[model samples]
Target: MMKMMRVAVFVFLFLGVAAGAARAGWDPKDDEKAQQAVDYIKKNAPALDRFFVHAYGFAVFPDIYKGGLFLLGGAHGQGYVYELNTLVGESTVTQVNVGPQLGGQSFSEIIFFKSKADLDNFKKGNFELTAQATAILIKSGMATNTDYSNGVAVFALPKAGLMADLTVGGQKFSYRSR
Candidate 1:
């Protein structure tokens, strides 16, 4: 029981620190930086144009910080969600995992909602990525052949960092109107 309590405290503290870090770097109202991020993704993976043109909505997180120590891990990031080229809201992603894991890394992630239902589910305030969901690493031709799985498609671009972690976690999100 004492060990479990210590683990709980560690997880809470880790998540609090990660949340603060995420908030420090994210400004939901910063449209200029958001656009730059979008541009970067588009420039690096032109194949994603099809998703931008066809997806009912999408969310882009300019940067995500993930780190783990021993049996605890956490990640956090803020993003903008758009529907049909119009900004609909701002969203935050948070993830926590428990397993044999360690190290830290940063990456950019984007999720494309293939239909209104999927977007609606995301905007409903409590949405999560199941363990089965996986993101494709962005590359020159990767997106060209990528297809949506279960009404959504995800792409990730590593910014910088190195980490060796074996963890199991699901990403959860909260949304707010812009």
Candidate 2:
């Protein structure tokens, strides 16, 4: 009986390792970056309808979780980044996992730019919105008019059932690379 229990534990641990390694595979059906980015934007369209008629100055980033435990053998964890488009009021989603890490958080942000140059940079870079760039979480708690940086205005409202209203903003967005 003890031997059986030990074997079961081994199997569970083995499968967990395998599952963690395969965490970075995105949908292969449409393999196009632009299309996926569009789809991602459309999924959250209702939240961003205010910018619908505009020429396209909005980008959506999704939620991300970053963490991992490194075994004495090696380190492993996963996270993704996305780019979005709402030119025709139809958006797209694209995803890429950052690979193994020792420790860090997976974070996603939906960015709405007010300038054409910023939007163009988004397209050319395949949507690498990093801290080197400028960003803020609108729906995020403690987000206020004062916290905004750059020329960007963060307008966020509730999307899910979250009751986070420490302050009032604009859109309720959920974006991922998809």
Which candidate should be chosen as best, given lDDT against the real structure?
1
- Which segments of candidate 1 are over 4 A away from where they belong? 1-29, 140-143
TM-score of every prediction relative to native = 0.85, 0.33
Cα lDDT computed for each candidate against the true fold: 0.82, 0.37
Q: Model 2: how far is 47 from its true place, Å?
A: 12
Relative to the unseen true structure, what is the C-alpha lDDT of residue 33 in candidate 1, on a scale of 0 to 100?
68
Which run of 10 residues does model 1 get worst, by summed lDDT? Answer: 20-29
Q: Which lDDT tens digits does candidate 2 get at residues 1-178?
A: 5675466446535744573443243555424543454355445444444443443365433433323222111112222222233322212332222222234343334455556665555445434423244333344334243322343433322233212112111121222344
Q: Taking the tens digit of each residue's C-alpha lDDT, what string does model 1 give over 18-94?
A: 56553444355577767877888888788899999999999999899988777777788888888887877778888
